[model samples]
Target: MTTLPDHYEIVRERNGYGSADGAVGPVPAAERRRFVAVDDEGVFDRADRRRTLVATGVGMTGPPHLGTVGQFLTAVALQEAGLDVQFVLADLEPYHGGAPLDRVRRLAERYRTFALDLGFDPDRGRLRTQEGAREVMHTAQLLAPYYDPDRWTEDAGDDSGDTDPPPTEWERAVREAYEAGEDDRRSGTAAVARPGPSSEAADIHSAVLHGADFLHPLYAGDYERLVLQFGVDEHHLVGMARRFRDAAAVEGGVAGLYTRMIPGFDGTPKMAKSIPGAGVSLATSADEIRERIAGDPGGDPARSPVFQAMCLASRYDAERLGRLERACEAGDETWDRARSEYAEFVVGLAERWRATEE
Candidate 1:
């Protein structure tokens, strides 16, 4: 019989001691919220250990953005707070359709270097590409059958004898739009703006038209397989994470795996890379960051893009940054002043952090 790690004890105390049933009466909102709050007043108690942190995300395309920086800060905070941290770079999410395979390879190399530049270890708490973790993919495949077809569809195609045509009007419209785009010279307004027949669009169509076919099945299956492979149920996994935290407490406690979903500059929703003007990238440089910050119209300083970047960057204490954010939102200050202040502050913070680490 395999015994749980000594570290597993720590994981249980912080995350495992909870009810599986999604109920709230026994657990107050304040208690539940503590699981995520990381500020000094909330739960960054410098003495509790039982947190284990892991971050997983797709990184096979596009440049690393401020969102990636936010995740890095999250991991850094955990490490600073004394938790064991693991950062997983998910690169297996298909980056190419058919051609340009070499481009994908180059992008991967660039991103790996970028990760290193950002201070993540390439070995210890370093990167783990999706390709490097095939078990995760396999697990996803095994769990496909458990998902409801109405809620999920697979890409089994005609092999499964499910040859039904696009069922919804939206899907039909998408198909028509795709077919109409074959001729580049099509001139109508609809033709001009129609979604192109790119593989990206095709993948979207497959998901919308088929549902749960490509990834959902894998997720549902692999989750169970992972539980067994690790010799722990869903509840146990939670326990392990918490136990890891508890064990780390003796050396200044540990930071839990909590992430804040910062909203976009427009205050509409969470900043998304795909949404036009939804976010700024980490590699956006000081000039771009300043420009975006100076241009935002949100009244609450807390909602200013500059402030958002600072928060995401974790460069300043929340209280001070909150004040700056508010000042920007109130229109009491000019963009130039705010931009100058933010840029200096960010540069100083980065220097201090690097020096301390060294």
Candidate 2:
């Protein structure tokens, strides 16, 4: 584990991260809203004050990318704000997604390394793999009885990646097979709607299991507050905190931290390694970072991934962040210097990670 600062206090690019922007103070007109919008900010704020456990729950299906670190950055904020952090590695999930078992296993094994390189504090909270979590599996079984197939699939949503095709009833197929495989299956009590024809039955099943895994800690009566950091698209997962409120009553409060996914270098909807030139090369240098920044069509910082990356790299460097954000909004030349400095930070990160491997 690397040494972490007492607090990652940075001049936020936006006012409230996931709360009311003006609730605390005044700022830029555009700074009012957060990159990730939450419908129930009031309740979430109440939970935020309690001892919190910040967690990232996602399958290890892809290589490390710029957007992946964004969640870590959010974790750093929550941790610095005094929340414990947990990295939920859904290692068993790729089995359902049709990804290679060996590849996913390797990714899962190296996830801790990735988190450390990204500056996660291990002593505060450690990474837990889903496949090995018996309690989580038990909790998933308990949760399964609560979710009929229709409701489960409806909430499951496709969660399709950029390269993935349309939804096509993927949830239905997976749930049915999962229920069938269950030795204690109940008929006519599962899903009402039939899923679209797709062979990927395990994907939805794994998601259900994975979601249950994350919710388990909250209901287990340990942590006082649990904050989950997922992408904007996965904000619906936040609703789980609501559902678990009754169960959480004896346990703790739960909050959701959702961040905007940075766009690709060419400004795709979200950055991914599969996005041709839009991908973040693990071997990128300071020069490559400059090119990406220079080509950026800076309009709203919310939509600009380059600018967002600078914000994440800055971490606790609030003054530098404020200057960058102010310069960016006004299209000032200071943004150039900001970009150069940010580029160094990005390059330094990759070098640190690379050196760790050596």
Candidate 3:
């Protein structure tokens, strides 16, 4: 599991990003707003708001979980803060996991509606797909050669079978999906067998598309500077794009804004759609969400799953969040009232989302 301390160290020191204290730029207005770190902070700090585009995306492997909801909210917040934004529905990604094309298309439409309902203004920005996006796909091919095969093939053990480091959350999720058995991707399925040498190469190639998801906007959308938002676990993709842009001699500068990874209830490093019952989602029942939040607030207020959900999933302002945090620490009645309100907020949002499908 990737601890917060170690993750912070990698972003701040190893990646040469500005520290959280130094997060000076156009950012979302949430409580405890920290960029964690931003690559090329100066370029981001000075980028023109009108000409800059902030991009974020989610995979269509599953429905809208709280983690995914948080990402959507971040995009809305960025747009409301005055910078143009683009939200990509990565329908093509689940296809790589063997999801049927028709099912992927349905999920992509659902995701688009959800983002609009969550306050992402189509007038100010764009909500696009990774599949059938002609220019973006072309950009991926153009950038493919620069993806650096060494990024993955290196440190891979020789035939002697020396083990590499532990698998990341993504790798673990993929492995578990394949281990369970074949099924449709609505339940988050994977390839039938474990990834072999050739399959591993395919995985690396998919990353080039991931790079294009971020870079294509700068080239095609006519944006001068681009800011990418993702969870801290996805920080490596920033370096991947930087290398590709430099190698390919692509114009335009890029920077990143990252959110903290919310730990899963299943004791996994982070909440994920592939992990059943890992955390609350739009599909979870209202009674269950209320019970879950009230039953266990977790040990630390800052690290508490309940509080984290409230911070990310709910539309609570910074002042209210601060007040609830203080009350939670004191174990007062205010916290109790606030907890019930938070549960209702999530429940109502879930109900509205479910209604869209019906």
Q: Give the alpha-carbon lDDT of every model.
A: 0.40, 0.54, 0.68
lDDT of 2 by residue, 1-358 (tens): 1101100111012112333333312222233223344333543345334445566855565555566666666555555545567877777766565666776676676765777667677777757787767887887777665544443343543222123322223223333344442422234443222222234557556756765766777767666666666765465465554453443333555555555555556535445543445546445665775677677655566556667766543463556556666777766677667666666666766675555445
Ten contiguous residues with the weakest lDDT in model 1: 224-233
Clashes within 3 Å, all models in order: 31, 4, 0
**Where does candidate 3 have its weakest 10-residue lDDT segment?**
189-198
RMSD of 3: 5.4
Query: After superposition, which runs of candidate 1 have C-alpha atoms over 4 Å from their true positions?
Result: 1-53, 96-99, 122-126, 135-258, 265-270, 282-287, 333-338, 343-358
In angstroms, give how far residue 69 of model 2 lies from its true place: 1.3
Tell me which residue pairs clash in candidate 3: none
Candidate 2: regions farther than 4 A off: 1-51, 153-201, 240-253, 273-276, 281-290, 297-300, 330-332, 355-358
State the lDDT of candidate 3 residue by residue for 173-258, as single tens digits. Answer: 53564344334333445312222223555566566777788888776758877777778667666655666677777788777777
Q: Highest TM-score among the candidates is held by which one?
A: 3
Candidate 3 wrong stretches, greater than 4 Å:
1-6, 21-24, 28-34, 152-205, 266-268
N/CA/C clash count, model 1: 31
